[model samples]
Target: MLTKRIIPCLDIKDGRVVKGVKFLGLKDAGDPVEVARVYDKEEADELVFLDITASFENRKTLVELVEKIAKNIFMPFTVGGGVGDIGDIRNILNAGAEKVSVNTQAVKLPQLISEASKRFGSQCIVVAIDAKLVTSHQSPVTSNGQGTDKWEVYINGGRTPTGLDAVEWARKAAKLGAGEILLTSMDYDGTKDGFDIGLTKAITEAVGIPVIASGGAGKPEHFFDVFSKTSADAGLAASIFHYQEYSVRQVKECLREKGIPVRL
Candidate 1:
C-alpha cells in the first residue's frame, strides 16, 4: 500500500497565517515563514499555502510570501488562492511551489485546469474544491451524517456557489488532466469534530487522482478516522497543528500505531 500523507495547511490572509470555523471569523495563527519552518521540522508530508482572501479581493497570490515559505520548507509545497491564469501558475511554480492549486478560477474557466495541466505536467496541477452540504433544513450542515446528502461547489473563498455538484466537478477536473483534488468541506471547516467522511468518500470515489481530505480535524484520531474510513490519500488540518494541539510527528505515530502506513 502507498504510504498515506499528512499535510498541514497555512491559510493566509493579509500575509499572516489564519484559521477560522466554516471559513468565517478568521484568527491569526502566526507568521507564514515561521509556521512553515515548524511544519518542516515536524516532518509534515507536504505543506499547502492558501491565500484565503486573494480570490475574493481580486488579487494575485503573494509570490514574495510564497517564496519565503518555500525557502524554509523542505517538503513539497502547494500554493493556491487568487490564481487567475497560466502566467500566475507559472509565477507560483517558479517561486518554488511543487504544485499550484486552482479553485475559483478553475470553476469559472475550467479550461484553465486543462491548460495548466498540459503546460506544467498534471503532477504540478491540483484542483481544489470547496464544497458544502445542500441540505433541506435551515440550520447549518456541519457533518455529512447521511450518506445521501448532496454537495454543491462553492468558489471565491467559499463565498459563492457555482451550482456545480462536488463529485461531478471532481470527475470533470480529473478528466481535464488535474493530477489531484484538494477537497475541503466548508461546513465542517474548523469545527475540529472530525472530517466530512461522506464528502471525502464521494470525491475520492468519483476521481482516480489522489484526494486530500480537509476540514474538521480536531485530534490525531480524526486523521486515523478519515484515513481508515474513506479512500483519502492524505489528511489535512490547520487549527490543530497551528495551535499546537498536536504535532505532525504525533499524528504520524498515531497512524502507524493504528496500522496505517506513513513515512515516519
Candidate 2:
C-alpha cells in the first residue's frame, strides 16, 4: 500500500504566505521561503505553494519565489495559481516545481490539461478543483430520497461558480490525463473542522488519479479520520501548520500510532 502523504500548503498572496477562512479575511502567516524550509525540515511528504490571487490579478505564478523555496526544500514541490498555458507550466517546472496545478485555466480550457500532460507527462500535471457544497434546492434528487449534496466547482480562487459537479470534473480530469487531483472544499477551507470526508471520498472513487484532500484540518485526529474513512492519497492543511498549531512530525506520529503508514 502507498504510504499516506501529509502536505503543507502555502497560500501565497503578494509574494508572502497568508491564511484565510473559507477563502476570505486573509491574514499574513510568514515568508514563503522560510515556511517551506520549516516543513522540509519537519519531513513533510510534500509542499504546495499556491499564488492565491494570481488568477484574479491576471499574472503568472511567482517563479522566483518558487525557485527560492525549491532551493531550500528537498521534497517534491507543486505550484499553482495564474498558470495559463503550457508555457507557464514549463516555466514553473523549470523553476524547480515537480508538478504544476492548474485550476481556472483548466476549467476555462480543459484542453490545457491534455496539452500539458502530453507535453510534460501526466505525472507533471495536477488539476485543482475548488468545490463548494450545493443546497438541496440546487442539488439533484437521488434514489435515497435525499437530495444529493453535490459539490460545485468554483474557479478564480473560489470567486466564480462554474455549475460543474466536482465528482464529474474529477473523472474528466483523470480521463484528460491529469496525474492527480487537488480537491479543496471551499466550505471547509481554513475552518479546521476537518476535511470534507464525503467530498474527498466521492472524488477519490470517481477518479483513478491520486486525490489530495484539502481544507478543514484542525488536529492530528482529523488526518487519521480522513485517511481511515476515505481513499484519498493525501491530506493537505494550511492554517494548522502555518500557525504552528501542530507540527508535521506530530501528525505523522499520530497516524503511525493509528496504524496508518507514513514516512516518519
Candidate 3:
C-alpha cells in the first residue's frame, strides 16, 4: 500500500480559519498562516486551505491569503472555494498553491475541468465534492432498484444541491482528467464521530485517481478506520486538528502502529 496521507484542513472565512458543524454555525479557529505553520510543524502530509465562503459570496479565492499561507508552509498546499474558471485556477497556482480545488464551478462547467487539466496538468487540479446522504426512501429509485443509499452532490458550501450522484460525478471527474477527488461528507462534517466509510468507499471504487476522505474525523482511530475500511489515499480533518484534539503526528503514529503504511 502507498503511504496514507494525514491532511489537516484549514477552512478560512473572512481571512481567518474557522470550523463548524455540518457547514453551519461556523466558529473562528485562528489565523490561516499561523494555523498553517502549526500544521506544517506537525508534519501534516498536505494543507487544504479553503475559503469556505468564497463561492456563496461570489468572489475569487483570496490570492493574497493563499500566498501568505503558502509562503509559511512547506508541505503541499491546496486552495479551494470560489474557483470558477481557468484564470482562477492559474491565479491560485501562481499565488503558490500547488493544487486548485474546484467544486461549484466544476459542476456548473465541467468543461473547465478538461481545460484546466490540459492547461495546468491533471496533478494541479483537485476537484472537491461536498456530499450528503440521500436514502432509498428519499429517492426510492436507483438504476438497479436495490434500495441502495445515494449521496447527492452539493455546492456553494453545501447550501445548493445539484442533483448529481456523488459516485457518478466522481467517475466523470476522473474521466475529465481530475488528478484527485477531495470527498467531504456533509452529514458527517464536524460531527467528529468518524468518516463516512461507505461514502468514501463508493467514490474510491468508482474513480481511478486518489480520493481523500474528509469530514467527521475525531480521533486517531477515526483515521485508522477510514484507511483500513476504504481505499482512501488520505484522511482530512479540521476540528480535530484545529481544536488540538489530535495532531497530525499522533494520527500518523497511530496509523503506522496499526499496520497501515504512513509517513512518520
Candidate 4:
C-alpha cells in the first residue's frame, strides 16, 4: 500500500507568498521563508515552493528566496519556476532544493528532462504542469481556467496557453525521463472546493511515475477523497495549509481516522 503524502505549496511572486482564486486576484500570504518554517514545524510530508512569476518575468527562480526557504526547512523540498538548463538545476540544488521542478522550459525543450535525469537521478527531476480547460481548440492550449474547448498547457504561471493536450504532454514528459509529475489544475486552482479528481486520475493513470496532485484542496476530507478516489500519489494545497485552516498532522490524523493508510 502506498502511504499517501500531504504537501503544502508556497506560491511565491516577488519573494512573497500569495494565494488567489483560480490564479487571479493574488493576495499576500506571507514570506516564503516564514511560511515554510511553519509547515516544517507542522511536519508537512513534503514542501513545494514555486516562484509563480519567475517564468512570467522571463528569469530564473529567485535563488535568494529559495535559499532562505530551503535553509529554514529540513524536509524534502521541490523548487520550481523558470528552470531551464543544467546550470539552473545545479544552482537551485546548490541553494538547497532537494529537487528541481521544470515547467515552461521542459515543455519547450523536452531534452531538458533527459539531460536533467541523467545528471541528477530521475527522482530529483520533477516536471510541473499548469493546465486549463478550453472549448474551441480541437486541442486548444489553455493558459488559465477562464474557459475553453480543449485542455491546454500554460506556462509562466498560467499566462500563456500552449495549444497542446495536457494528457498527451503528461505521457511525453514521462517518456522523456521525468521521474515525477506535479500537476496543477488551473480550473480548480484556489477553489477550496476539491481536486479535479478526473484530471488527477487521468495523469496518474497515464504516467508510470508518481503524480503529485495540486490546485484544489479545501478540507481534510477532500484530501482523503483525492488519495482514495484517484490515482494521485500525493495531495498538494496552498491556502488551506498557508492560512492554518488545517495542519499537516491534522490532515494525516484525519486520513488515519478515515481508514486511509498514511505515514502518520
Candidate 5:
C-alpha cells in the first residue's frame, strides 16, 4: 500500500505566507522560505506553495520565491497560482518545482491541461479544484453515482463559482492527462473541523489519479480520519502547521500508531 502523505500548504500573498478562514480575512503566518524550511526538517512528505492572489491580481507565481524555497527544502515542491500556459509551467519547473498546479487557467482553457501534461509529462501536472458544496436542487448529480449531494468548482481563489461539478471535473482532468487532483473544499478550508470526507471519497472514486484532500484539518486525528474514511492519497493543512498547532512528525506518529501507513 502507498503510505499516505502529509503535506503543508503555504498560501502565499505578496510573497508572504498567509492563512484565512473559508478564503477570507487573511492573516500573515510567516515568511514562506522559513516555514518551508521548518517543514522540510520535520520530514513533511511534500510542500505546496500557492500564490493565493496571483490569479486574482493577474501575475505570475513569484519564481524567485519558489527558487528560494526549493533551494531550502529537499522534498518534492508543488507550485500553483498564475500559471497561464505551458511557458509558465516550464518556468516554474525550471525554478525547481517538481509539479505545477493549474486552476483558473485550466478551467478557462482545458486544453492547457493536455498541453502541459504532454510537454512536461503528466507526473508534473496537477489540477487544483477548489469546490464548495451545493444543494442537490441547485446542482446536478455527480457522474460517479457515489453520492447524492454536489459540489461546484470555484476559481480565482474561491471567489468565482464555475458551475462545474467537482467530481466530473476531477474525471475530466484525469482524462486530460493530469497526474493528480488537489481538491480543496472551500467550505472546510481553514475551519479545522475536519476534511470533507464525502466529497473526497466521491472524487477519489471518480478518478484514478491520486487525490490530495485539502482544507479543514485541526488535529492529528483529523488527518487520520481523512486517510481512514476516504481513499485520498494525502491530507493537506495550512494553519495547523503554520501556527504550531501540531508538527508534521507528530501527525505522522499519530497516524502510524493508528495503524495507518505513513512515512515517519
Candidate 6:
C-alpha cells in the first residue's frame, strides 16, 4: 500500500507565517524558517510554503525564504504564489524548491503549464486551487453567486475571486499538464473541524492527478476520515501543527493505530 502523506502548510505574508479563517482576519503564526525547521526535525513528509499575498514582485522574496528554509530542512519542500512564468519556476527550482505550485498565474495563462512541463518535466508542476463551498441556491442563478455560499477561486490572500468553477478548473489544470492538484477548502481553513470531504472527493474524481486535501484538519482522526471516505492522496494542515498543538509523529502514530499507512 502507498504510504499516506501528512503535509504542513506555511502561509507566508510579508515574510511571516499567518493563518486566517475562511481566508480572512489573518493572524501572525511565527517565523517561516523557524516553523519549517521544527517540522523538518519532526520528520514531516513534506513542507509547503505559500506566499498568500501574490501580487507585486514576490518572486525575489519567496526565493530568499526558500533558500533560508532549504538550508535547514532536508524534506521535500514546495513554494508557491506569484510565480509568473517558466522563468519563475526555474528560479524557484534553482532556489531549492522541490516543486513549484502555480495558481493565479496558471489561471491567467495555462500554456505556461505545457511550456513548463517541457522545460522542467511534468512532475515539477503543481496546481494549487483555493476553493469555498457553493450551495444549490447559489447556482446559475449564475454558477457565480454572491456571498460566502459561493465557491470562488480566491488569489492574493482571498482578495481576488476569479469566478471560475473549482471543479472545472481542477480538470482543466490536469489536462493542461499539472502533475498534481493541491486543493484547499477556504471554508474549513484554520477552523480545524476537518477537511471538506465532499469538495475534496469531487476534485479527486474530477481529475486524474494526485489530490492533496487541505483545510479544516484538526486531528489525526481527521486524516483517516478524509482518506477513508474519499480518495485524497494527502492531507495538509497548519494551525494544529504550528502551535505545537499536534506533532507529525503523534499524528502518524494515531493514523497507524487507525490502520492508516503513514511515514513514521
Each model's total of backbone clashes: 0, 1, 0, 9, 0, 0
Give TM per candidate: 0.89, 0.89, 0.89, 0.85, 0.89, 0.86
What does candidate 2's lDDT look like per residue over 1-264, in tens digits? 679999988878877777642222223236777667667888999999888768534344388777887887788989998899888899889989999999999999999999999999999999999998876564322212123568899998899999999889999999999999999988778678888877887888788889999989999999998999888899998888776788989999999999999998
Candidate 6: tens digits of C-alpha lDDT, residues 1-264? 788889988888777777731221223236777677667878889988888766666667877888887887788988887888888899889888899999888888989988897789879899989987665565322322222334557765556888888888898889988988999888777777888877787788888888899988998889998888888888998878766677888999998898888887
C-alpha-based local distance difference test score of model 3 = 0.83
Q: C-alpha displacement of 104 in model 3, angstroms?
A: 0.7
Q: For model 1, how many clashes?
A: 0
Residue-level error in angstroms, candidate 3, position 99: 0.4
Stretches of model 5 off by over 4 angstroms after superposition: 20-29, 55-61, 137-146
Please, what are the lDDT tens digits per residue for candidate 4 over residues 121-215?
A: 88889999998766554332223323233467898778888887888899999998999999988988878888877677767878999999988
Off by over 4 Å in 3: 20-29, 55-61, 138-147
Which one wins by TM-score: 3 or 5? Answer: 5
Ordered from best to worst lDDT, the candidate numbers read: 1, 5, 2, 3, 6, 4
Error at 245, model 3, angstroms: 1.0
- Tens digit of per-residue lDDT, candidate 5, span 1-264: 679999988878877777632222224235787677678888999999888667534344388778887888788989998788887889889989999999999999999999999988999999999998886563322223358768999988888999999989999999999999999988778778888887898899899989999989999999998899888999998888776778889999999999999987
What lDDT tens digits, residue by residue, belong to model 1 across residues 177-197?
999999999988978888988
For candidate 6, report its TM-score: 0.86
Cα-lDDT of candidate 2: 0.84
Cα-based lDDT for every prediction: 0.85, 0.84, 0.83, 0.80, 0.85, 0.80
Q: Say what the RMSD of model 3 is.
A: 4.6
Tens digit of per-residue lDDT, candidate 3, span 146-234: 32678999988899999999999999999999999999999888778888888888889888899999988989999999888889999
In candidate 6, position 79 carries an lDDT of: 88
